[model samples]
Target: MTVRLDHRRVGLDRESLAAAYPSASASGRVVVVVFLHGLVETERSWFHRPRPGKARNGTDFGSRLAEDLAGTPVYVRYNTGRRICDNGRELADLLAELVEGWPVPITEIVLIGHSMGGLVARSAVRQAGDHPTPGLSKVTRLVCLGSPHTGAPLERGVVRVAGILGMFAALAPVARLMALRSDGIKDLARGSLHQDHRAEYGRPVDAGLPAGVRQLFVVATLSRSEGSLWGPLIGDLVVAPSSAGDRTQTADLEWLGGLHHFDLLSHDAVYGVVAEWLRT
Candidate 1:
């Protein structure tokens, strides 16, 4: 019942992954960019891993972002299958631990989350609350790609069926705790991360924004158009442009066209935009 976040194991430790790059000064002002991948995706999805669909591209978004961010301090997180809010809480805890133990004087933290990862990042930021440490005080910027800030309208029967199976599995005590802790119910209730939320839930993290954290929204419009499963609906097949950008008074949202949710991570064009945003 517990959703496994790291499927590939990726051979990287959190300390090493969170570590600033060599060029980054030991003094304050190091920018730690954490890229969170969407549901059913690995950290490899952010850059390059082994993908059955594409032979040339090793994986997807994670590798691509790493490549684009060459020489920059980057950490790619691969945590899929957990509930969105639970993942956010875990992220908050991890950040708290990192900041508490960090040797160097940390300056800035940037969270670039794609699809459901974006929602998770927002939740983490919200949980950081009023007196955020290095996690939020150092957090200068946040970018969300194809995330359904509002709850998405499910495709209907699919998630319901899966929820039933998950319920059966949760009968075991260990799995029951895991299921409850993972935010499985929330995910199921909201359907998949890809569904667009026009009415169901409120903006994913709009209600949970911490005081000083900055926010950005990057949405995908088209995917191949001809043979791709994603149709031209101003969306990444799952989250629409509006849903991705939906926020209350405290957010600064941007609209990026011509990409899918996955492409927002891997595609060079999308990567360039994100890089530019970070630079600004």
Candidate 2:
């Protein structure tokens, strides 16, 4: 019943991409921001909303971002099961169509990616810069929320565990199952995105960042005792601050305390900071 092998894609792929633009139905203000979800996530993940009255304890970061910008944000619903570079390549093509038939002239283009999505976004932007994508011309900003720009430490643990499991006959099946992670997940390895030259998943390379495109990284810490010994080890319980912040190379870093991985999605403080960035 579902179309496109993913979404209900009855129309042309280009048509689908064009239709996803926030400016398609809006007027004048043609600032479009594309929001990409993390691993194993889809467009629906962005629409996560809490109860009508519960704002503080809600789970709608995408919608909350729209409210902050006073505009709608475009959601990219792709197969997270695919390799990040593969998705990034497709995204580069899609963005061309997304803006080619813009009902209104696009004034600004922004990308906000979460986790693996951030890697994809980074890859796509690099490809766009090399290729001819209309969307790239107007790209002014890129914001990554809890994105492991360097690599995801948790994924390494999984790989190690998978390797260990394979050594036992009884756990071989479990190892195989765990090893079934998408190529995208495997690409989350250390320096995965730092390919000397882009090949596949090593995406919108921090090294290959387009000129004039402002980049912002936001990292969250869950430990109440950030200054303690295990603060870096327990950062958001997945990505370490050193990786998330990338402070040495990346100029802009925002560190927030008391938030986990998903918590970065809908945190009010984060929204406020992003909103201010958008305004400027």
Candidate 3:
């Protein structure tokens, strides 16, 4: 798994970083917007044009951020099979290296993650606090889109079904198959952010957001009205609104209706909200 800058492969080395962003060093101060994809997803997932015929090139969230916000977007591609905590630690180290090797001075860093990627971002922030990563100091904002901050009911249900199947000798193999899901997927069941805070198929630990960093938790619902009965029941057809973020009164949360979980990846409305937040 490698990190990409504007869709081009970029290594952590100074030379690679310089080559990747030829004009970055000349910029007075750079704002790096990092994009992390969800489970079983690659960096390209963020740039996917669902309606290619209607969408032009460079219209994705990252590209739009580059144009609308004048921020550099870096996409991360990692193995989703690993545990969230493990990936989080690795991401922290990677960001540290990126900052250290960057051609220009980093004024701020904004992390935008979708689904499990959001959990990875939160975990990385926690790991950075424990390890004192250089990049963590520059991170000004952390955004999670349709992340299961509480817990993902779908994953929980899967584990329950697997448990029931395991009780039957004839269905044991099927249960084992279900159990083969990656540790990353298992982490989603409880939205585990840290190793110590993890539970065995239980409620998610309420690990608070990092201090001083502007946090935004975006929830997407397939229903027309988030206040409707089906809104909370079928949130984006994957994560419920309650699971995506705390429903309490807070300025950090935003809700976008009539969108699915995957739609959060590249939807124009999603990008609009993110861009406005970053601008502020």
lDDT digits (tens) for residues 148-241 of candidate 2: 7777888878888999999999999999999987777777655345234324322333547677878888888887665857778899987888
Estimate every model's Cα lDDT from 0 to 1: 0.56, 0.70, 0.82
Best by lDDT: 3
Residue 134 in model 2: lDDT:
79
Pitting candidate 1 against candidate 3, the one with the higher lDDT is: 3
Per-residue CA lDDT of candidate 3, range 118-156, in tens? 889888887666687798878878999998887788998
Off by over 4 Å in 1: 1-28, 49-71, 76-79, 130-133, 154-185, 188-205, 223-234, 247-249
Misplaced by over 4 Å in model 2 are 1-29, 49-59, 62-67, 165-174, 194-205
- Candidate 1 per-residue lDDT, tens place, 62-123, comes to 34444555323345464455666567667776666555545555566788877777777776
